[model samples]
Target chain A: MVALATQTISSMSNTDIEIVVDDPTAPEENSPAVASTRVVDIVVSLLLLALAVTLGWDNWRTGASWDSTGPQPGYFPFYLSVILGGASLYGLGAAFVSRREATETFVTRAQLRRVLAVFVPTLLFCLATQYLGLYVASFLLIAGFMRLVGKIALWKSVLTAFVFTAVMFVTFDIVFDVIMPKGPLEAALGR
Target chain B: MEAFGLLLHGFAVLLTGKTLLLMMVGLVLGIFVGVLPGLGGPNGVAILLPLTFTMDPTSAIVMLSCIYWGALFGGAITSILFNIPGEAWSVATTFDGYPMAQQGRAAEALTAAFTSSFIGSLVAVLLITFLAPMISTFALKFGPPEFFAVYLLTFCSFVGLGREAKHKTVISMSLGLLLAGVGMDTVSGQLRMTFGSAELLRGINFLVAVIGLFGISEILLTMEERLALRGHAAGISLRVVLSVWKDLPKYWVTLLRSSVIGCWLGITPGGAIAASFMGYNLAKRFSKDQESFGKGRIEGVFAPETAAHASGTSALLPMLALGIPGSGTAAILLGGLMVWGLNPGPLLFVEHKDFVWGLIASMYLGNVVGLVLVLTTVPIFASILRVPFAAVAPMIVVSCAIGAYAIQNAMFDIWLMLGFGVVGYVFKKIGIPLAPFTLALVLGNRAEDAFRLSMIGSGGDMKVFWSNGLVGTITTLAILLLFWPVIDKALTSVTRMVRPAKA
Candidate 1:
């Protein structure tokens, strides 16, 4: 299929013959909304428009006019907000109208699943940072990924995570003397 | 003759045991930071700036500056080895660098990159040593209008000349501008876009945003595969390194031209990332092997690395000669200077000739040291690529989280970074170019501030940008560049008509 498409593209310069061909279809995979560029564009545009309204309203409240003290704080920002809304609206319109990108998928289902596998863990790690502090949270996060995603041995993952977090403690906490967030473990250790 | 003498004295001061050891330490730290995603040159310097607070300002600054050098050199390592840009400027390096790694010429590519960077930084430092005093005298005449015009040119150049989805570029830039405007409206002392959230009060930090966008998004992208780091494994030897060296001089024109671009843009506020972009574009435009650029061309790696290093180093020239910082890292260094009782204006040249000359001398030695150090370490850094993707990806996330948290010690920033990462991933998935977004995020606030101040100075006259020849010419050129497609179309059509008539 790929080779045939390439051949057609190479022969495209010969304008005399008009070729009608459909792309070779594979079994359809379930698509996430993020996979569609059009869906993403519309969503992004609407959010930007909302941002414009919020900004424009705030600017008006703060007196978007030029007082005797020259332009108000919101004057320049207000105009920028307008441009943002305008550009985004145009984009939203274009997204719906564009023919070339009618069914183009941004990513396949498998790709999203892969991204989520890493992303969900990272997010949980961020939430865990508040409770466990940087060091403990990192240890768990690293160990989790190592054990779960990597399918490594429990001892190996624990050891690698321990060593990694231990090195970080020495570097940032001890050597650079940088003050990182500490949980109960650090507090008890008197670090 | 006098420069030669000053340079000798500078070297004399630079070779001290404490300074030499400190410079090595700086290079090591830089490599450590630069090879990691999220931790960047500016952030690395900012983090270490406090360590220098107790030491002698000169020695402290020498270490800090060497870290910057290390970080700049370090960026190319990861970009080539792991397809991650540790620094924003190294984005261009990944174009051909990863391909070279895939082709098993990783050693050759890395050698060219480091050597080209050395040449670029060496040329910039040399230019600074001789031309700084004179160039700064000319820079004193610049006003807000001129600054605004220059910024307009840069922003427009990205949006106009670069072949990307134009609307996407505009949308990305607008998002950046909007993000930058959040927090406080400093001009009027009014809060805009804060939505009354305390986190919004501090505004979004560009570095944190960068961490999320490049570092986190890259991890997500890597996951699509079963995830093992891959590299070209012909391996680094003295032979390959020497072969790259011998082949390097053939592209001296690219090296020289990119260095010049890096110097000019660095001295201006266009900065390292812009310089790299301009260098890569210009190299592509002029190269005989244009098609080979993103396909592992050695020259592609050289163009951006050299230009980025040159600009990253020479950005100091403006900070020393003028009070203005030409780059984010330079600004932090300037803040450090002020804390240590050294003003960074013209008076700095005379007030502390030893310090200035020593710093300059250290740039020379630092690049040499950095190149030698990083070249030796490339094998180790590259070998890390042999690790399974699952282990490495998680490690990248944790380090990125720590790096993000280390900036403000706020878990909120990490959350924000995660948001940016997802956005970055989606943006890439959709066809949005990130270079313009990052540039706008960095420079948008300054450009907007300059325009407003210029307007205030001119009593709301937009023509203030054209009031002086310097500003006017820049404004004209910016306008021309903004409409370059139309101008380009008209010119080409005219040529087409003339050729047919003549034929």
Candidate 2:
């Protein structure tokens, strides 16, 4: 069992080589790093490599060679996928070679927290838009962000959200008459 | 003279009250978007594009082009007063502009920047007026091989000229091409890479990608940085404008050189950001007082602003003439043209003469109106930046969401936008150039089709790209450009070796 685990680890390291080192210039920060640049680089390049392989395989499946009509549908994309794979390999190799960037912080603990603070809410807003509709979702998003993240007074946040939503409704629905996702509230207040 | 007569007829068509009103409205909206962080010319136009969907093509093009002009002018405001570049092209403007603002010369710097932009745009418009017809006529002779060669040249130029890593650029561009391939193949009637999703079958929309990449990614990036905006108060009066105009003639050579650089980059795909930096660098190299440039020299302000505006304006020429966009915003405009049921190649000149001329005429009129509006309303617009970024951030996000959904009126598009937003953020962080990615996405299928058509015609002969002088020259030039970095290095090394031996 121990021998098998050691062999598997060696194979994994050989396949996706990554070098982690300490940066001489990196500041001793309290926030700490969420991940090193080398790790992110390795992961991203590997993802790109996987994408290229999948695309290449799919294109090949769909007839990449030339036929009676000149070229097959997958001919161009297959070649493009080959180029992509080559580029991804170059990126992966560069990441492993470049020692200076290896130890660099991709993002700090605090920074990632802040990024997630916005990203999470935005994702929720998008999800909310599906059911609550655009206007209500927008109102909740604006008001909630301002109140929770921005730390504005409740009244002020509510007022700003209300006015903004009203203007959007007037502009998109009434003035321009562009169709948007409507919820029960909009349906209830029918023309 | 014939072009001039058509231009006058175009002016007549654009002089209507409704069109004029729309122009002003577009300009104001454009300035608002430009002054705000996380929003810019390309996505600004993208957001407003759906609004123009129902309008006449001429009026719609006029409004959109005016927004382009307005965004160009508005970028200088933030660069000069706030020391924060509102657009990528305006980053160089802050080198001297902010220092001038610190010395209480904000109004003068503003005037010079605005005036230089006007002159640059004026020159670009004139270039378009004369050159558009000639280029389109030339393009009329192009066949599939020639078209493929041109597209090859366009993509190769990005690799050759772009400052980003060559591997990264290749990756980004190839990724875009792959994304463009994610629908049913038009030629073979075979599904390419839909992954069994009905939504993917319709293909990824460039507009949605642009909004997410530019708009949503910008907000996320801004979130990473502390978003505090403090700007100098700009109060430009008639006297300030006049005084700046008097000093401007002293730097006429700088202005002229920058404009020329801008026009060249614009006509090519070097883009406005590259043009601005080149303009600034060239001006500094030629100036007698180079040391004073970063220390508050007005010439420093003049060089970049002029080049950026000139490049931005003239980028439309290729889009009009060759159906190839020279910049990102121009790509969006090209998309708008297609959405309007107007084919955008050489035939556009022959088929929609009125629409073509009217847009050109609007370019001239719009710049004049934009100059006056931006100069007089600088204070009001600058104050808009005073709004807390917290409030402004959410508003911009909401606008991006609305714009994404409005593209196809589908909820899936909104989700796709969010996905692209994350992708864009990561791409930007990793030093991959977004412009080539966008250009590839927009032009991918067309280039592929042209390639396949050429192959069909030549019975799969690889020499078809070099079969004719025109196609051969373009293909050879593209190959040369693709290896430009290597050639450039070799030439420098050879010169160094020879010089030492001679010594």
Candidate 3:
């Protein structure tokens, strides 16, 4: 169960390098909790604080003082980073002291599962588009989501996906002539 | 009267076959997007913006603004029938709209909602028609300090009036400013935060972030609840609309009050969501039958829809006159304005009178078109909601991906869009406001330019913002608004102490 939860979180996949956690209190399907609101709050605020510090350092290095022409490029961003850092600190402090939030679930396990179930597939669809092309990847994604998550009949999902992808291709590629990524299949078919 | 001549010229510009066809197409597409769960005005506008890249600026704006009016009308459909707000601003509509639907008055509720929206938009357009030119004329005199002060007030108002936590709003806004500063610095011609990536050189496109934040993140959020969109059946015949129109005059006070509230909020940064809730609450408070509110009252539907549409329409006024977007969708439209090689702000009125007046003219015609289209097609849109979310969600995702990729024909944008989507999901779940983030991102560089220019002019003096009376007043107002939450609490506590002593 812990491994499954970790896998789900890590499924963010090429989206970012945010920390992933294995919450022991991720709860059962019946219980409505994946992590406490306090924990998520602390994590997010800390992440923001880190971002603020990094940005502040970068802006400082880039020249944050006023020059002859005007304030330097980094002057504005440096002050903005300061505000961001201060706000993050305030958020962190508030989250730590807020007892009411400590009892609340950031997202229930069932809700997180539902969210991740769609998100992981979406990330994969984006990755797959690089190799398989937009239309093919989209067709597979829609069909797979419909069949697996929606629990629809196989033929219905396949048919729906095909029809949808065909309409999109016509609208974009044929009608509007908006250029999109085409793959080996389109290359083989010539133009 | 000069404004009248300009508006007539605008109508003449709009009286082309191609423009009318685009209007109808935009309305239909707008309604379709609005009826869906995850797609709203901002997302719809962002997704379709690229399609207008080659069109004339006047026609493009007309079509895009028509989509906005259509979305405003379409939001009422889901709120009335499905008890789900298709748009965030329409959430208040579900209070009485869904109740009326449950009482077998879905048609009546939807008709009232659409009619009120039409009335609201009409009033706002009238305000814009007469007021925008004058404001722009006044804004023509504004210097850099004044522009910076105005931008300061715009961002400050979000912190002051937004419902989110103060710190979260600050964090969201500053983060956007940071992101906006990532690419090449326009004045210095130096990279600020690109690190070393080649893709970062072009900067993060607002369109991609919009598609990801509003479009993709919305889909992910919708998936969290496993929606079953079993909704009330609605059949809006002409008779139902006529009856609703006849009954509408009885609640003229609610209509007028809501429209006023919407216009005020829309012109400020209070926004459509706040306007809707305030409109509903005030209507309920002022009504004799307040108890009937939230239980199937037609006035309940009227208040929120009217205010939402009105504010959503009027939010464009500031964007036109001052180059400051009053809402998220308006911000995207501002981005589109830049993409079309037309500068926003007061100069736009003088330079691109045709485009400006043409858009104003379309706001009038488009709302009428939207009202008629929605009244006849509510049933079709409501049924469209009956389609399974699983099927619809993926299609929306694909459209979003296409929108992102189409920005610069870059695959990197698609990946960046996915990243922003995850960020959006996390931010939303943690109650970080997205509106300020978007507005800040769109307006950040412009504001920085104004600030730096002011500093340059004033020899890096901090008092430059307060050097002149006009700039000083605006700067003071911005600071007051930024600290309004604290000041308000202090005043309230003081009032409480005084009242107790008097008692």
Candidate 4:
């Protein structure tokens, strides 16, 4: 994606015109079917508004009542929700009226791939921790990442992960005497 | 005599076998991480902080402070050899240091930078040891108003003094403040922006944010670029290193000037980058052979190296004495102090004298170790640039994730780490200054809490802040800082108008 952007920028630099002309070679950069900035702004604003209303309503029902001495549990949060909703609406209006050209979108397809590469594994690690315990889950996570992302050999990845997790276990569990969460794997091991 | 006695006692603690061993380990680790491109001082310290969690406060600080020194020394190695600065402060060094290296003067440039860094850090450490107590005593005069003013000054200086556009810096700072407003409100115990998520109740940890922004984001950026792999073929000799001393006297004036600029900027929260840039420009302007500066002038390399180390070291003074961190690394150190259950204000010296003094003593010892270690291992560390990005990038990500999780042993923080990683990537893409944002995030909640407490103590009378002389002085300085750009522009125009007429 960066290569494409760089190519487009370099080609544009070589042009004689003062204004930016569409480069024929870069299809994505020159595409005319892209979503309008106003449409995105409105959709994001509405989603935020729904979130604010839901949270504010839930707090009003479940949160602590106000006392004369000070604020209630939901006092500060409820107000913040309102402000967030209001600001989002303001953004929506600004996007609607602004005559400036639509800027580039933040989350392109390439950017999404980058985000998912880290995010998916992290999600799996969190779920795996409950069943395998912190140490085991972290070991597997590290080994898998080393093999998959780092492209290391199987034995090397396994060895590195084992050493890393073992050192952490020794330091935190034995030395610090902090209790780690024991899951089914530890229970089955009976130690 | 009393200060000398206390320092001796501090040394007594620092010289113990356990403390010395940990300090040495930290120094080596710091140098290793600092020499690696994109993994500078803050990331190095954050990655290693969890290791010291079980140790006593004094020993932990000794290790961490040594790590800080080692990282400062390590940054110069890559700057001189590879033309890739390990830290932003080392950017100036690449102007001349890399040129010298290309000309087969790599050993001399490395030696000059190492010795100058040693001298600069030594001066700053000496100042901290003697002057910290006095600074702490004076800092007792500050209330919330003064602290608020200082925080404002810190933000403004980054905006005003930075090379980036002011609007972008302000946006980053506001984003940080918004992030800081998450979690429960201190006064009311009311959640602010948690959105009913239990993890958000505790707020985002500063370490997690820093690791994600500086560490993980850097790795991702490295992955995007097709970096040229440079081979390490040259070896530095002791004789060539020793020859740097011959040119030392010629650059002593630049060294002194850079050191002063470093200390002043370091104290005021302007940080190492500002000090180094200013020092580099000043040295170039004053040099007899200005044309040779960017090509391969020894003085060009010496000035920034001295100022960067000096400023980086002196930033600790405000952090230790006043609970005010003057740079990103110092902010991480402040977070470390908090994790060790030690508050960093005026009373830290009184209540935790051994820890404070021991840390100060370790700074001196660590500088010596850092200089010797980095000078000896420059060739080996420069080889790190030859390693494939794919192999190292994932390791960086894993280290940062683990570091974040270790902070609270919570899986939720790992997610926050990823979120911050995305924020960092966006900030970089949009040309926003991440340093100011990180600085504000570190100081925001503390500033808010102080402000609230002060107002409550003063019976909600805002006049109380202005009535206090010290607070008033700081507040005035902050106001002046806000208008500094306008003032500077007007002054420059007047000087230009007057000079032409006089001529």
Query: Every prediction's TM-score for the first chain?
Result: 0.79, 0.82, 0.82, 0.66
- Each model's lDDT comes to 0.77, 0.86, 0.87, 0.72
Ordering by DockQ: 3, 1, 2, 4
- Residue B85, candidate 2: C-alpha displacement in angstroms: 0.9
The residue pairs in collision within model 4 are none
Q: What DockQ number belongs to candidate 4? A: 0.09
| Clashes by residue pair, model 1 | A35-A106
lDDT of 2 by residue, A1-191 (tens): 00001112232222221111111222235778888887887888999999999989999999999898899998999999999999999999999998966778788876677677778888998998899898999999989988888776789889998999999888888888877887888888882
In angstroms, give how far residue B182 of model 4 lies from its true place: 3.2
Q: Per-residue CA lDDT of candidate 1, range B1-503, in tens?
A: 67778888999999989999999999988887687544578657755665665578789889999999988888888788767777779999999998987786777888888999999999999988888766656765768898788778766766776666677777787778778778887777778878789998888877677777767887776555433233332335678788988888799889998999999888765679888988999999998778888999998999998899889888888677765567767766775786587866666777788998899999999999988887776655444333445566677777777766766668888899899899988787667767567667666677778888898899998889889889999899988977888899999999999998998
Model 4, residue B476: displacement in angstroms? 2.0
CAPRI-wise, candidate 2 is: incorrect
- Cα shift from native, residue B131, model 2 (Å): 0.8
Q: How many steric overlaps does candidate 2 have? A: 0
Candidate 3: misplaced stretches above 4 Å? A1-29, B496-503
Whole-structure CA lDDT of model 2: 0.86
TM-scores of all models?
Answer: 0.78, 0.94, 0.94, 0.82
Q: State the lDDT of candidate 2 residue by residue for B51-170, as single tens digits.
A: 887789999999998888888888898898888899999999999999998888888889989999999999999999999999999999999999999999999999998898899999
Clashes per candidate (backbone, < 3 Å): 1, 0, 0, 0
CA RMSD (A), model 4: 8.4
Assess chain B of each prediction and give its TM-score.
Answer: 0.73, 0.98, 0.98, 0.94
Better of 1 and 4 by DockQ: 1
